[model samples]
Target: MTAKKEVVMGASTENPAEIQDGGAMELVRVPAWEVKYKLDRNPDELAHFVCCRDLDWRRAVCGYEEPEAVILENPTTFCTMCVEVVQAHGGVPGSGRCPFDDQPCPDDETVDRMIDERTSRP
Candidate 1:
């Protein structure tokens, strides 16, 4: 059996969750305060605090709408819903529900494919 090669990547704040070299994209842990500072008044830029689940679906990720969400996802006072979903998803949920979204769950075909490819090995 060959071990899967791990590649560490740093995505720009403009495009945070891009999957690189066919690898699962791990979100860079940017502090909520720093994000606000960098974003300034750029509405298009992402202001994620608690993995808004708004990332690229191909990367198998996203949710919240900012400011308030950022505050809620603070290390000291994260929202219960956010924490629960995060826990359920193993840090990054394949089909996790976002606290901001009304829908219960989101589609994640990438995760299904990854499971099949990794587990079907003999």
Candidate 2:
């Protein structure tokens, strides 16, 4: 099989999970810090900053909103749903466990790989 040609694409902080590929759409790894920082501030502000500043989305791919979550046996990814859960639970301090899992959240590398593989399809 021929290797898929990887293309560089930009994504907004408001919705990083969705990526534009070949006029179609695919999900990809959007660094954790981008999501976390966006979660910390107003979504509109974050989106504006991302557009104006062209923030680096690959630098901190392992950031977490909750200080404790990062130290858990398995760290969880900071995604759109994760942000919603955190907000519903009253932010990081109020969120004690992973919303999706009973144990803990998945790690950064694990989440990144998952996204990469899913989006690398031909």
lDDT of 2 at 46: 15
Off by over 4 Å in 2: 1-85, 90-97, 100-102
* TM-scores for the candidates: 0.23, 0.26
lDDT of candidate 2?
A: 0.28
Residue 19 Cα positional deviation in candidate 2, in Å, after optimal superposition: 32
Q: Pick the candidate with the highest lDDT.
A: 1
lDDT of 2 by residue, 1-122 (tens): 00011112244445433333422222454443333221122222211100011122321111222221111111232345434544454444223334223334335465445334333423
Counting clashing residue pairs in each candidate, in order, gives 6, 1
Each prediction's RMSD over C-alphas, in Å, is 16.3, 14.9
Cα lDDT of model 1 by residue, 1-122, tens digit: 00011111234444423444333334444432232211133343332233323332111112333322111111232334444555555543324544334345424465334323333424
